[model samples]
Target: MNDQQNLMIKVVLDNWYSSVKRSDAIFNSLTDEQLLQEAAPGRNRGAYLMGHLTAVHDAMLPLLGLGESLHPELLEPYVKNADSKTDNHTPQQLRQFWSEVNEAVASKFNALTTDEWLQKHTSVSAEDFAKEPHRNRLNVLLSRFGHLEYHRGQVAFLKEKTD
Candidate 1:
């Protein structure tokens, strides 16, 4: 890669890393009970938000050709019980879960290559790649970052309400 391209990739990765760190700090301030608490009547729990962040990271890894899966098992706990009128994680479990997932995501981000970052891949389902267009790796990465930020905001707002 050219120096400029390398620099750009570094910048992007660095920004993502910074954001994740800040989000993690915010999450760390909450008790496990708070982490699993629902923000509102129909909103997601804090654990669910963390799980969604982790799942998106896990899902996008293969698309980037990184050849590693992250937190596949934990995905269901975050997404499956939504709207079920029950909480899925205890406060302690939520804290540990977010910590583990956040660590995995940071590790993955650190290991990404410039070539991988620029590659294009289809986010098609098992049966749909032939019919769907490919998405750029950069776009996918940005989307995940944005997704994390979106959930972070929700969690932060919930923290305020709960506090």
Candidate 2:
């Protein structure tokens, strides 16, 4: 890649990490009681949302051609259904899982090269990606960043609850 291309890739990655850090701020603001409290009526609570975000981040490992998940068991419990028992795990355990998984996601993301960010992810073969190159690591990062922000918005109601 040329200098400008390399710079652009780093810019995007940096912005993506910035967003994750902002979400972490919101995630860190919760109380043990707030973890179980619903961010809003008719919605899943903070604990479930934390688990779901962790599961999503874990899925990105294999998707980014990194490696197997550190928490594959989280899939069914967190991703397969949103109606999981709110008390399935203690608040402290859920908080630890959230922190651990996000750190794992960041470490794997840092291992990728600038060119690899433009390459097709593990889900698409090179031939197919050749036909549609927009489906790349950069794209996944953009979408997942949006996913984090979306849940971050959901959790914003926690502050509202406290107010």
lDDT of each: 0.69, 0.83
- How well does candidate 1 score on lDDT at residue 58? 70
How far residue 115's Cα lies from its native spot in candidate 1, in Å, is: 2.0
Tens digits of per-residue lDDT for model 1, 29-143: 7776676677666787776777667666776656666666656675676555453435655556655656776676667767767776665654545345345434557777787
- Candidate 2's C-alpha runs over 4 A off are 160-163
Query: How much is the lDDT of residue 45 in candidate 2?
Result: 88
Give all TM-scores, in the order shown.
0.77, 0.92
Candidate 2, TM-score vs. the true structure? Answer: 0.92
**RMSD (Cα, Å) of model 1:** 3.7
Q: In candidate 2, how many clashes are counted?
A: 0
Model 2 score (lDDT): 0.83
